[model samples]
Target chain A: MATTDKRDPRVVRTHNDVPAVALRLLLDEGWEAVTPVRVATEAGYSRATIYTHWPERIDLLRDAFAQFSEMPHHEASGDAELDLRGELASFSRAMVEHRLDRALATLAERTQTNPEIAPIRNTFVADGERPMRHTLRALAEDPAAEAALLMLTGMVTHSVLMHGTPPSDEVLDAAVDIVMRGLAQRD
Target chain B: MATTDKRDPRVVRTHNDVPAVALRLLLDEGWEAVTPVRVATEAGYSRATIYTHWPERIDLLRDAFAQFSEMPHHEASGDAELDLRGELASFSRAMVEHRLDRALATLAERTQTNPEIAPIRNTFVADGERPMRHTLRALAEDPAAEAALLMLTGMVTHSVLMHGTPPSDEVLDAAVDIVMRGLAQRD
Candidate 1:
């Protein structure tokens, strides 16, 4: 039977709990250890229950990743520069705090061979990029916006990969200032 | 007997041949398929022969990765702006052509728990970063230099991760120009 009933609190809790459990395993032990059986067992759900909900291991992973990939909502203040800086910092913090940079890199490597995971991986990229892209477009046009977006994201991702840690606040602020100054000078 | 003899042409040939063979398998089949047995069979060397050269599977993978991760050399043309631009383009081209981005991304993820691979991964990051860091230092100082390096690298890497390819020559040039201009305006 389908398990999509909103009225049943137990079903809703199980649905929410599965991905959380799977994500913890993924973070602790990498993707190979996140099998459906292991997730169900650790989550205190039955095999059939997890199967009914996710059906595929990739589906479970997609959900788990999506949970962490959520972007911060930015309400622009009167100062576009200040707003952009705040947004960039928030983005960097979220990525570091959730360990998305490492997770995304791991998944990006996998997407090269496993076609099934590419869409999930793309969603992760798209979701993360959307807010930055929006803010950049508001500040600059066409090629400049694209360049800024790449630079901002590149700085964050590169720092994480190189140091195995998210960049410090000072670094993030300095990066945003440099890029913002760069964009302003173009005008 | 030690396999490091200088006079033996055959040993030298086989010694050089194994990493190339393993790299090809890595590129064609992904990292999982690059086992010693498979590599020896493909390269027409015996397993014992390959083992003698590398001694461990991680050793073989390290050599294969090092082969791909070799960064390009960029000489200063006296114009710092032009030099930085050229360096950034060369870096992007090398990363794309060699598939170092994808390969390093894979290795970086493994380095977290695989202590055996951490040193190898560190070398890859350090080698890639040295030129960029050098160029940035020549252009700007301290936090700005660091930020520029991160942004430049991030742009190249983000393009690779999102598109499964390196940034195009046009995009790379435009990106360099934007960041260089940004740096120039800082002074």
Candidate 2:
């Protein structure tokens, strides 16, 4: 997977640029739209260049997914309440910015008839859920990590995607307050 | 539209049966597959009869949506906690039974490029959200109703659609507890 010249900035730009193009198409159009040829055209790379790096549609999708799934890391403030609120708010913003709801809903739709794509979505969700779960595990135990994260995801995603807007701070505060309150009661 | 013979059981069956056939197609194949011709062929009704009732694709989609959107009612037990938990658990079960997550995610995907289809989702969400709001409003007034509902929707949907299973009772209990705790803290 290494570029021919790792030290060359030009090669490095191609490494990132091609996948970003693929990711854009993947998000805007469904997976079928993302091909090595299309990525080369969009990214100003030769088809041979893209084919050399990504030989298959899945390779492009997986690489594009790596970009599609990027999240701005949240530095935990030691205040679980603030941390959770910040995480959910950032998620709402990201969904709107990336049209992530469309991406995810499309994934959900595809997984119905195409079972192989489930892993793509599972990987995407697991990457995001893994870290958040670590911070949230303190709220109760293992199961709470899952349930709480799903709740926050639903809250943020439903509002952003369904309503076509990010949730208001008022809703965010209440949601965060609810989770924290649930944890506090456990204590 | 009144059937020619409103009292005839065969006429009543045709009235409900045709739309149900359209609904099945809409849920399984997305909106484009549901048409008057498809419904007539599936329901064994004459194409002319179907056209008489549903002259356009929008007519078919709207009628199909009405059938697609039916939900079983949950009665309140005068215990808010029990009511909320029961509601969420049933939602998870219903989602599985109806493949509701696919239907909803498809609606979500369609709403992206088709502004006209937006009201279909809005009507669906509003239908589900309205009564839940009445019960959840007891927690922290207006805003909590919306936020809490979204969280619950997310929790159930992420589990059911993404993971291909419903939330476990343990997970459902924890989610309900968290929101209730948030409400108690506010009080």
Candidate 3:
């Protein structure tokens, strides 16, 4: 069964279960409130089993965030603005729905002081930015494309963190329109 | 003479000197090494005077960061790439020359936990990002502009914090060239 389980359904389920339980703990309480013991007990797993998979809470979290940043869940619409808006909406909704914003913020703040976590955090940023880069590159020349990507990411991050609400879908649509139209080749 | 003495140019110099001394102490040693009494003594100011202005050591540090972020010390060139390169260079040099990266990182982490300092930190980010937004707007027609900005900022920040050195001037120039060319309007 172990050999047949190359795509081991059980292992996949457990791996998936770990992050979900951890994320819920993070969102329901706060980052500070989560402990490996708590997570393992909550997930109905033994402490040793959880520890065997992730040596520490930080390792588990690093993996959880990596999973969170993975691009596939955010399906791309062929339309650039639509795609971008949908992706951002996914981020915003996740923040509000899970109440994960505070935990996420805590993770970000820790990146500055904790050398081990900083690279993991940077990796998350790089991965999240990839689709935006690809979309922007196709839309305009380098300088313009680069600026648009930064602006979009920065604006989205700032809006969510500062306002605790994503821009209205209408506002985001307008922003995408302005950005895309602005980047369109001028005579 | 007491009233005039308080208003003396020397007093102005003395008031301004406190933060400078604190900054030097922070960089020369480390943030943990800094104390309000030490800063006051180093600046040759009375503890009462330092307290009158800044109620806490963190308040003093936050004010220093605020002053530093706001100073119109570096001018941006009209050309987008040149302007960005200039800004990045100045920031990198400042971070590198004083060996302040660790201290600043520590302070940034403290700000997250310290409610009083968090707003000050946010203000600094908002202010620093304002010029970048203007630059992005001007270059909006180019899709690459936005991504270029993000990458460039990421590169500079990463280079300094991770690599612990300012990138060579040649490298900075080349990065600017690549981004500018990448965003150049399609003929």
Residue pairs clashing, model 1 = A154-B154
Candidate number of the best TM-score: 2
Name the regions of candidate 1 deviating beyond 4 angstroms. A1-7, A70-78, B1-7, B69-76, B168-170
- Residue runs of model 2 more than 4 Å from their true location after superposition: A1-12, B1-12
lDDT ranking of the models? 1, 2, 3
Give interface RMSD for all predictions. Answer: 1.7, 1.6, 7.6
Give the per-residue lDDT of model 3 (tens digit) for A67-120. 666334357777877777776676557656654355445555455446677766
Q: Pick the winner on TM-score between candidates 1 and 3.
A: 1
Q: Mind giving the per-residue lDDT tens digits that candidate 3 earns over B1-187?
A: 3555657676677667877777667656655555778888888888888888788887777656655564453486677766777776776676656443554454444443456756765676566556655665576553444444444554454444433344667656655554454355423
Tens digit of lDDT per residue, candidate 1, span B1-187? 4556765788878867888888888877887888999999999999999888888888889888777544456777767667767777776777667776667667766765566777787787778777668768888887888888888787887777765666666666667777777778775
Docking class of 3: incorrect
Residue B21 CA displacement from its true place in model 3, Å: 5.0
> What's the candidate order when arranged by decreasing DockQ?
2, 1, 3
Provide the RMSD of all predictions against the true structure, rounded to 1 decimal.
Answer: 4.0, 3.2, 6.5
Q: Indicate the TM-score of model 2.
A: 0.89
Summed over model 1, clashes come to 1
TM-score-based ranking: 2, 1, 3
For residues A1-187, what per-residue lDDT tens digits would candidate 1 score against the true structure? 3456646788788877988888888888888878999998999999999999899888899988877754455666757677767767776776667766667767877776687887887787778778778877887886777878888887777767655666677767777777777777775
